[model samples]
Target: MAGAVIVHHHARYKTYPGEVTGFVFFACLIASVGGCIFGYDIGLTAGLTSTESFLILFFPDIYRQQKEQVIKNQYCKFDSQELSLFGSSLFLSAAAASLFASPMARSFGRKWTLFSAATAYILGAFLGGVSTTFPVLLTGRILLGVGVGLCIHASPLYISEMAPAQHRGMLNILFQFMITVGILSASLTNYWTGKFIGGWGWRVGLAFAAVPGSVIALGSLAIPDTPASLLLRGESEAARLTLQQIRGIGIDEVKQEFDDLVAAAEESKAVTKPWRELLFGGKYKPQLTFALAIPFFQQLTGINVIMFYAPVLFKTMGFRQDASIVSSVITGLVNVFSTFVATMTADKVGRRALFLQGGTQMIISQILVGTFIGLQFGLSGTGAISEQYAMCIVLFVCVYVAGFAWSWGPMGWLIPSEVYPLAVRSQAQSITVAVNMVFTAFIGQIFLTLLCHLRFGLFYFFGAWVLLMTLFIAVLLPETKCVPLEEVAHVWRKHWFWREFMVDTSADARGAEMRKRIALEMS
Candidate 1:
């Protein structure tokens, strides 16, 4: 927060620099392709349910038995538990990869770690495509998860640091917007390829993930390393040169800015601090608590529950297989468009209102979904959802997705990165995201089974996810919009005076010596 002020000296400013900002935007655009890869791989998993390659890879015998028994449309059938494992393996392993990837990323330069991840990503995709058996396919998914592990951390970090501070929020949010785009791309790809070419089209879709994953890996080689990170590693001259190259600033200006950032980074070391210290320590415990809890609550909406099993859901809603996959494409489109609005408005709208809107709408949507399901059974008195009332069910679920895209989806990535301090940022971001994916794994499997066995009953679980999320958001959510990342902990601190200055607020405080230490360090 201390060095957040953007200095634009007229004397230092030359004539209009045509497309300088454009080039920077392009660089970030290319670098963030990893986000698209992450989104595509994860989002495509559900839609892949419509693909025969996915089925053949998991159910070789189903196809063979169909040849012998002539079971007609039931060629790909599997037990609920078996089907659940096949669908959920990708998320479960990615969650595991995310947990360890966070700390290692801090030590490794962001670019190199991502490169390593890309190799794994590419290999995973190829293997997943050719996998003849279940174990191989599962292995492929785990490897892809390793690649995603590095990307989910490094991609956003790269965007934030490379971006100008004034525009950082939206630019960083663009990473998530790209995520929506990737998901949409995957869903549409799945729909068209599966419907037109038949279910085996997943081979093509799985192969497509490799393209962006490879681009990000190669692209990382092109960009200069982040100046701040170099400064942290004692490569000050190199850091200054990198900053000048990227910022187009005079040597003196860049040097002064670099020193100030490092100085503040050092001072903030003592405040409840961000990330690792920010979440775990005494002063930052509450802020950290909110930071951790928000993501926990975000996933509870059972959003992934829907995403991972959307095709299965649409089928239950009474669509044929192809129609169901096409509907998933529509959901993907809604997700992409809504995220675009969020990227534009999050900073302009500020954080509090969006967070509130997101949580509140989720609650409404889930309750309505449950109500619609209950009515379908109660009024129709049959397991089938009535055709007349179907629109309401689809629209409410769409509204829930829109709310999430506007709020939690992008904000999940934005808030933690912004709220945490420099040192702990990587560590904490990794843990928060890891937990998000871990739960996604657990719930993703459970929800698919529930949808089949319980039918309309699946909405009840989501309704509960919404209820718990609402209470957590209402009570624990912090207003982080416009708050500089470095100083978020200071405002959120609970110790009366500590709340004021992020240390002992006044001489009367118990930790006066600690306060003095922080004050001197700050000065």
Candidate 2:
């Protein structure tokens, strides 16, 4: 069967020829620009909302009242509801846009979908940068949300399809790393702009999103559509050529891969079902469950809460405005660096292990953070928190970010891209991304309000979820370390106990069986 042949090729072509490798790297890098935009949108608001200059220009009444409170040595306050709306608007629009991402990708193809998304980002950035009213700015954010939805839905799918099985995890995870880079870039931009430009800092910070959006729009032209998409469209010869050019292997090797892809494509067509059947029917029940569960658990980790409000969280812990913004930058740095760790190790350590290890650590970090904040509130009330205790909270928050970066941050996108069959990959990915955005919006919308009331208890709420996530990953997620995409369907069919704990050997057996089945069909 082609699956067996693919496994043999996996062993033989441990590294792609230089040109193929370069093309794959370039393609993934270009697609990853969407990730940078996603990060920037998420990170920009953290600083923008915290900037007094921004507040004075947009929310003068709250800014003036806060200033008076500051003058009286009382804690300054902003409208929590307004801030929540400001942060959650993008996710709201993103969730709505995600509903259409699958159809767009399926109808127009991944490359064009990304190009359109980049265009949306450019328009959104322009609107945001020049907004004279809050509604205009919110509308701009809603536009960016459309772009974010398309990009998040398409980028990882494109990368996963293009990348070789052995390197797919790392290459796809690169999207998350780029997101971290974007966050870090936004954080630095906010710091410099806030320090110098004051009132106009957020506008400049937001406008910078257009730079990467432009890069993606232009750079996408250099890459071809995925062979899988081509095969789906019955362009077998074109798919063959693409596999040849991107793989840079010998004729026999290229033919072998082409055959495997065609076999998978044929199988997909044979079993093609409507979206209702694909999602709810027994044939794809496991895949659908996995697709939905992973993204749901990913958001439950409370990572977005921190990304959306890190500076404000720091301020609540007693740091000055500038210091809190600086602290958020540090968190961005940790996020970027730790995502790099995930990129390097995702293939090496396997997805399931990282999920388990990272979830455990996140649970601990959240608990500790909750404890420190609780002690500060209980012991000191409105008095100054001890510097040591404040530092502890910051450290634990970094730990929590590191845990999320190395696990859910990357795997949440990567796993769905791999697990589903190519036929429904786009649709499944759209559903999963929508799930992600829904939870992100829910958390982002209420986090500030929660902080107003729950205060340190918010950490406890997140901690409880992390514990559940740890159990979920340990008990459910099958290891997909080096399993070829064509054969991943078999991974879900194994017994639940084996899927949880003994996936490596089971994947091998499943791959062999898959190969035999394809061989029989071909004969």
Candidate 3:
């Protein structure tokens, strides 16, 4: 509570009024389907590309190469522009779509924006399932990427707005938790489909994405819009009612919470062009920096290096295709379980602690994997390491994935969603989603090439990044645990570094008056 301004309102309340309730839980569950779909796409695409049917149909050259085993370097075997385009194109389109997600969410509401995202994802899945040509498949990938953009932008925001302050971190993490669930589901789907369904298994795997898409689409219709979003839309009475409903309290019971929401919404009204203010407003420098940097650093953790291409990496490491796909399932399981651990501890241990601990684990895992690969393959980077060695590498990769599942993976979305004021919340989140995808696209495109050329050095590069981001968190990020969204500004303004940039004359005056009033009451 250092640098906090504590104001007592009433005998019944301590600071703010909110309790965990079923309505909010239901809303979070539905919104979390957005993460599931995104994860399904990531997990399915990696294994689908490695499938015999998918390769023979869309990438015959890669299929021939897989059969030949003549490429000397296993790492370079699947290094084809066509395959890279298929893997990376979705991310590029997602980045593009994220730029527009904020405006769409602002105009139509978070629920409908998510609805549209699910619809787009379903269409993309259908197109991919029936594709007769590479262009058609590529088109489908881009379409689904667009769906991911909108969902990534809206879902976390919706959850953060609806969740009570006490449980916000735990609740917001459902988005990441669902993502891990989807990855696991996709991995199991890929394993079973490839084993039993024969040549068309990849199609079934791709089509199954529609199942989660349908969940989000139907679920979006049932959930109420967030009170903050309703307030921003000038639906005051509706906002009040929704707040009461979600808080599971009577109208009079929600009055203090309603007033706080209204005050935050009114503060946002003065900024007519949030985007312009976000980029140029000196006061928003910390928020703007955080929006761009957190996601950027999250991607640099190279969690996607595994998430996007686990089966491929395993194949290079010497596992047979079937075994490689199954190995991905192991990692997926670790990711889900680790993220569950995070949901339990994030509110208690705090964000910075997890960031530092997880980053350290990731660094150690990355360096160990890199050193092993270097010794096993020598400078040739061609031979498959022993079966035992390959399994060891998989274990290390799981360590890295586990570290990410709990920390950067969820916090990347949670911090950005909770940090910004309503005025620039959407814009800042768009920046976060877009930056993340852009880097993801870049990684997807160049990873094989880097693996081929850098050999054992690829892991080291990511390990270095983990080190830097860890230092960044240790030095710069303030603990935001259990703080109300509207009260987050005080935390920033009182920080040793961010305080200098958070200057607001009117806000300072209000804060001073509240402090003085509280002091007098205490006396």
TM-score of 3: 0.94
**Per-residue C-alpha lDDT of model 3 across residues 44-159, encoded as one tens digit per residue:** 98888788778888888888877886777766767876787788888889899999999988877899999999999999999999998988998898899989999999999999
Q: Give a tens-digit lDDT track for model 2, residues 1-523.
A: 2223323213321222223378888988999888999999888988887888778777777667766664311122343676677778898788888779887887778898899999998999999999989888877889999999999999999998898887888899889998898888988898899867437767888889899999999998888888888887788788878787777665555654566677667665654563765665545666788778888888778898788777877776678878887888888999999998998998888998888888888989998988887776753235566779877877888999999999889998899889887767888888898898888888887776666566667788888988887887787777776667876755665646534432233324444466556457654
Measured by lDDT, the strongest candidate is 3
What is the lDDT, from 0 to 100, of the residue 209 in candidate 3? 87
TM-score of structure candidate 2:
0.90
Q: Assess candidate 1 and give its TM-score to the true structure.
A: 0.83
User: lDDT tens string, model 1, 1-523?
Assistant: 1232322211111111111376567667766776787778766887765455566667666445534563212112222556667666766676777667655665566667678778889999998878777678788888888888777777777676666555666777888888887888888877767755445677788888898888887887777666555655566687777766766766654544455445544453333434535454454555466557766876777777666667767665656777767767777888888888888887677666677788788878877887786666643324555556667877887888898888888887777667665656666667776777777777766665555455555667776776776666556555555443433454456434335435432322423344345445544
Worst 10 residues of 1 by lDDT: 9-18
Ranking by TM-score: 3, 2, 1
- lDDT (Cα atoms) of all candidates against the true structure: 0.66, 0.79, 0.86
Q: What TM-score against the true fold does each predicted structure earn?
A: 0.83, 0.90, 0.94
Which residue runs of candidate 2 sit more than 4 Å off their true CA positions?
1-20, 68-79, 270-273, 379-381, 497-523
